[model samples]
Target: MKLLIGNRNYSSWSMRPWLVLAHFEIPFEDEVLLLSGDGWRETLAARSPTGKVPVLIDGALVVPETIAIIEYLADLYPDKPIWPADLQQRALARAASAEMHSAFLGLRGHAPMNLRANHAGKVSADAVGQDLHRVETLWGQLLARSGGPFLFGAFTAADAMFAPLATRIRTYGLPVSDTSTAYVEAIYGLPAFQEWLALALKEPWIVDDDEIDVIQGRVARGTLA
Candidate 1:
């Protein structure tokens, strides 16, 4: 299987399935498609059905979209505990993942997942407060229910789904509950996540659209030193 991803520094969607594949020790190769620069959109359009990263290519089957790729991984590796073993818990996890797929626009918009930059106190609380409240409530409920270092007590696909959110929380200095903070730390501590972070820090490419400082006029594009 070959997973086509975007730049590690800025592609939140790419991070999800890559974490799953790496965490589960699944045998697969990953190819990086630069998310910006000349004709990058055309490149993605030609390669992906949805013109997005995190596309899973397994033989003739092509899976686009983050949640779909994760579902495919879970189906392909049922024994690997991609989702919780309990049926109800699995349903809840899927629900949360779906919410992550659709909701949280306020936070996501104000705080794009730039792993390299630290823009603490830059994002206005008013802009993302409601979204952060929802995230805290959801994370708190699940962590309490699971008694977790992760959402479901183990690093499931649900955690992978929200992994970039965890990065955003820290990168933007978003206020969250203690439970959420610990969960964020747990995500950062994961071996798979650590691997991704190390690669992200090393990446030279920058997506100005995702860079809060660049967008806010605090810094010139491509001038990060």
Candidate 2:
């Protein structure tokens, strides 16, 4: 299998399925497609049905979208515990992952994941406060129920779905409860996430659209080095 991903520093969507594949010891090769450059969109279009990052290519099958890729992986490896074994738990996990896919626009808009940079206190609370509250509530309920270092008491695909949100919470210095803070720390401590983070820090490409400083006019678009 070959997974085509965008730059590690800025591609939150790409991070989700990659973590699941890596953490589960799945045998796969990855190719990094720089998200910027002349004709990059055309390149993505040619390679992906949705013209997006994180497309999974397994022989003749191509899986696009993070959740879809994760579901496909879960189906491929039922013994791997990608989702919880219990039917109810699996349902909850899928629900949460789907919610992650569609909701939280405010936080997503204001706090793009950038593992290589920190813009502490620069994000306005008003812009993301409602979404933060929802995150805290949802996470708190799950953690309290599961007694987790992760949502389901182990690192499942549901946790993979929220891993980038964890980065956003930390990178933006967003205030979350002790529970959520611990959850974020747990995500950072995952061996797979650490491997991704290490590579992200080494990346030279910058997507200005995702850079808070560039969007806020604090840094010129092409000046980051």
Candidate 3:
């Protein structure tokens, strides 16, 4: 299998399946496209049907979209315990994952993921602020259900789905409860996630659009630590 991803620094969608693959130790070739520079759409369109990163190419199969890739992985590796063992838990996890995949536009817009830097500040927009609060509520509920370290016990696709949001919350220093803060820290400390973050810090390319606070004259954090 060959996994196509965008630059590690800015591609939140790419990080989802990438995290799943890495966390589960699934073997696949990694392909990266620099999201910056000329004709990025043309470049992506040539490879992926959706023209998006995090697409998985498995011999005859060509899969696009983050959730699709994750589901494909789960199907392909049925014994990996990619979802919860309990039927109800798995259903709830899927619901949470789907909610993350489609909803939370405000949080996503205002808090673009940048693993390299931390820009601590309040999100001024009413919608974005509400989104932040909603996330806190959601995290608290999920963490309570799972009882720590990950959204679900023993990391699953659900955690992978929300991984980038953890980075976003920290990067923007968006307000989160201490429980949410602990969850964020636990994610950051994951070996696979830390590997992604380390790679992101070393990338030469940067997306001007994702550099939201820096462009607006806020002090940029020097490290992801």
TM-scores for every candidate against the unseen true structure: 0.97, 0.98, 0.92
Across residues 1-225, which tens digit of lDDT does each residue of candidate 3 receive? Answer: 999999999999999999999989999878998786789879998988987787899999999999989999999999997888889989988998999998899888877888887677745556477777877888888789889788777788998888999888888777678998998898998898998899889998867767775545563643212
Candidate 3, residue 35: Cα displacement in angstroms equals 1.0
Looking at candidate 2, the ten consecutive residues that score lowest on lDDT are 110-119
Ranking by lDDT: 2, 1, 3
Least accurate 10 contiguous residues by lDDT in model 1: 216-225
Off by over 4 Å in 1: none
Ranking by TM-score: 2, 1, 3
Model 3 collision count: 0
The lDDT of model 1 is 0.92
lDDT of each: 0.92, 0.94, 0.85
> Which structure among the candidates has the greatest TM-score?
2
The model with the greatest lDDT is 2
Name the runs in model 2 displaced over 4 angstroms: none
